[model samples]
Target: MALNRQLWIAIASVMVIAFVSSLAISFQSARAYFEEQLHLKNIDNANTLALTLSQVEKDPVLIELMIAAQFDTGHYQRLELLDPSGEPIASRTRATDAVGDVPGWFAELAELRVDPGIAQVPDGWQQYGTLYVESLSGFALEALWDTTVELFLWFFGIAAVLGLLGSMVLKSLTRPLDDVVDQAESIGNQRFIATPEPRTLEFRRVVRSMNILSARVRDMLGEERSRLEEMRQRLQRDALTGVGNRGRFDDVLGALLADDDPNRQHGLFLVRLVDLAEINRQLGHQKTDALIKELATRLGTVAGEHRDSFSDDHLARLNGSDFALILTDLLDAKPLAERLTEAMQELAARHAEATSLQLALSAGRFGPGDERSSILIRLDDALARAEHRETTCLEWATQGEDVDRLHGSDEWRAILHDAIEQQRIHAAHFATRRIDGRLIHREAMLRLEDARQTLTAGQFLPWARRLGLLPQLDLAVAESELERLARTPDPDGEPIALNLSIDTLLDESTRGRLLGLLASHTARAAMVSIELAERAAIDHPAAFREFCAVAVPLGYRVGIEKAGLAVTEIDVLHELGLSYLKLDRSLTTDLAASESNRSYLRGITGMAHAIGLTVIADGVRSAEELTQLGELGVDGASGPGVPE
Candidate 1:
């Protein structure tokens, strides 16, 4: 059925046909030549014997003796003598009709027939009697059979050698076709990668055409990502400093506070340049802007050093003189605030335009159940007190609860370890649906419960990550999801999408274990989807690629959550056989107001759908946003706004 095999069969058939035809022609020619030679020998020998008899005396008894002597001396089947009147005769005949050493089948096929040689003899004065002489043909037939067999063997050997040579040549010629087939299959899988062109003229043309198509798609993705990034910067970024604006900061903080987990808390630093007006008056606005940009960059770098995952939105310029730094993890704020002060002083010393810079830093913690207005007022009050000190300084805002009461690192680690080992880890399912209200899947978020309280992933994931137990937690979540699927085996049941941490995917041993579990429950695994954060997937592409390569084949739909955050990695998306891409909640917030973001999202959905990936929006808070998402060709959306 394969093309290569078909070609081999055709070549073999041609060789067989040629061998048969050549053998038949050669056998026929050998048989004719042997028959002619035998005929001539029989004629010559018969005439010679009859002439000898004519030279001798004619006698019945003597003639009989002559015939018997001739038959005994020569290779003959029969010899005869007869009178001219055909009344009396003397004859010599071979008693046994056996073909010596030749096979019966070959003898039947040869079937040699040569006319007997005949001659006349006369008496002394008159014709005493007419004599008849004939010669045998068994030896002649045996010679012809040997020649035919030798010719057949020669033809067979030549055909076998030609067939071997033809097979090798056919393989070489069709090697390029194999590559073409592989390339087509990759395209079918939606991984648009180009392959090298082959030397065969026809195959080279086809491959080059496919490569062009792949390149076009890649270029389109790159162009769309560039456009989306440009629009996002315009909407969410500060023009002068390139960090997030006040609006972007509010969005991130609001989302963080809106989480259902009361234990979710992070440190926030509000830094104000106390002398921005004075600096702009004394130095040019350009110098002031440069100074602000420099300070923002240094602040972002410090935040990056403290946190493993860094983003531009983490450091934002709230206004002309105020900048905010959000650290997602709870740490000793004084030490980090000291580092910021040192960085600011270093910047002041290096700036040639400014004589000196004064700043007031307000540090505090913010979480759920806290009012944004009240927290800002407290931090502003703290900033006023720091400004009253008359020197560059930092002050901590008053908190309703003591930070020291929180669990220590070892305690949290033990708690997480016990929860996983004791099988206390579970998941809460959130349904995502299509525009037509059909259920797509139920997204699973990890939850940990104890005797008195329940903890969401937003509450405990940071600690789990800090304690390096995310791999265990992720495995626990996958196991829970698998068991849930096994229990609910209805064909119409919505699949559960399990979120896998980048930590587990990056570790070889953990990744192997996860894949092994999926392999064991292959049928049930089909009812579960695996997903990773967009930023993590972008940061570590090799691990994401390897994860997809393994998980996708195990009947798991692999995808990226919080997608559209990193637009620059769009080119890598087509290379990864992803099942879906979930747009971040930030992209959909107030979608009706921002035409730029709508266009950006439209481009994302277009490109994603072009490659056969389903696009979903996360945290849609209003019917208006959901309707707009549907109008933009988004496949599905999930949030408080989407009705169950």
Candidate 2:
């Protein structure tokens, strides 16, 4: 039982016991008082009657008439005149029937007994007769019952009023305990919250201890998070130039290309420092490093000027004497390339005045769906052409003459619509396993099929998203996966995870359709897990939360994929009630060699685990990386190194 109920029961028991005891004592006292008063009244009446009869003339009829008058007027049970030898000469009797509204049980329990009064009457020198008088107890019994009922009413009313007041007081006094419980629950969810200390000394002490503990935990997590962020920056940045390193640049490029949005254009510029060896031989390594840093700074400035045009632009130092600039959505890349070339030339001119050094800049532009290797190969070819033509000659790759069957947005939309309508989407399964080789789940990657080719999500998803057809496509993928899961039973009974697009979650009709489909397949629903990108969840938290509210109760697990990219919003992890988080490949790349990345991963994994979320490392390319991830407390891993 709750404490409140227990308290009320205790209080009520005490009140009832006291009331019953008091009523018993009071009823006995009132009954005794009535009996004593009746006895005294009978004695007094007998004495007065004896005195009056002694003074009266001796007549039988007169005596009988006097006895009858007394019996009629005084409400007596019996009245009689007796001789000196104890023989009754005249007597009157009345029935005892007037006990008003008192129950028989109560009258029996509180019955009052009274003795009749006796007196001697003398006529001149001799006793005439002995007189006897007695009063009925029915009236006294009725009065006692009334008094008992009145006493009970007062006691019951007082007890009820006191009980209500006591309940209110108890609830107020224990209200702090509710706050304590809520705070404890929040802490369990990895949300460090504190409650105000109660005025009661013992409760106050307990609350104070809990608050202190919460604050200490919050401080520890905050410090660890700060250190991890610093380490992450060190791992991603080039040490000398403070720009992105080669690995960071590659991760960004892969993400951009994988998006596959045709309208999103990007330009890649490769700047090579010519005659770096000559400069080093003459001026030393320190001067060459300083020159490279200065060039990196200049590239950052040029990129910053066009930041609005290319929101996802970045600069990186690829290697010695080689730096690259990547800009997005630059429809006219020639002007930006020309401007960057001029900036490098200006730097080269200033450096030449002091030493014999030159800068050769080559620029190349690649559009959506272009392979990363092909872009690099084409940029290398352009750089070679520039180097052969002259020093510091800028070149741009010409658009290809080869045409795709789906040429425009309308054509691509039609193909995607038809594919979704016909359920042409298929899934590729990848296994995520624990360190001990136990399979956690299989992740599903969506694939689209057509007459010409089988396309990956990267090939067709961007077009679907651009055309507002992502919800339809995602629903189709889910339905197809559900059907497949129903048909193919896994020996291990591992669940299949499907990735959800932001559009699918935000669209009400799509969410409804997906939910209906899942609801129909109750057995298969339990075998399905949905993964949402962390960025998308953060962007539309209300919609994601609403989706989770429905999904979680229906036996569907929800996870956030590519989680580490949005570490700043890590608090949302608890709010979303996620089952797992997939660390982005960028953070997990080269984990075996990078101490900074390891420390960062440890902090992330710890924080996620504290919130009851399993952390899985993505793109684990080697056993060493997997081992390091295990040491850092990662729950599972999936990539080329792990078996499918």
Encode model 2's per-residue lDDT on 331-449: one tens digit a residue: 34656777888887788788876686566666666665788898888888777777776566676654541223244778888888788778787888889888777887898887888
Lowest lDDT block of 10, candidate 1: 304-313
For model 1, how does the per-residue alpha-carbon lDDT over 1-644 read when each residue is reduced to its tens digit? 97657766776688678767876887788778777777787778778887888888766688778878888898777777767767766777877556677788878887777777776666677765554544566676677667766766876687667767877887788777777777777777777788888888887999899899878876877777777678777877899998888877776677666655576667788888887888898878887888888888888877766553222226789999999987764544556777877776677667644456777888888777789898888888988888887667878888542266347778888889899989999999888888777788898888998666887776678777767788999998888778777778586677788888878988789889999988888877667778898866767878788888888878788888877546445557777777888887666666666675677778788778877889998877678877888998898988877787
Clashing pairs in 2: none
TM-score, structure 2 vs. true: 0.69
C-alpha lDDT (0 to 100) for residue 490 of candidate 1: 86
lDDT of 1 at 26: 73
TM-scores of the models, in the order given: 0.81, 0.69
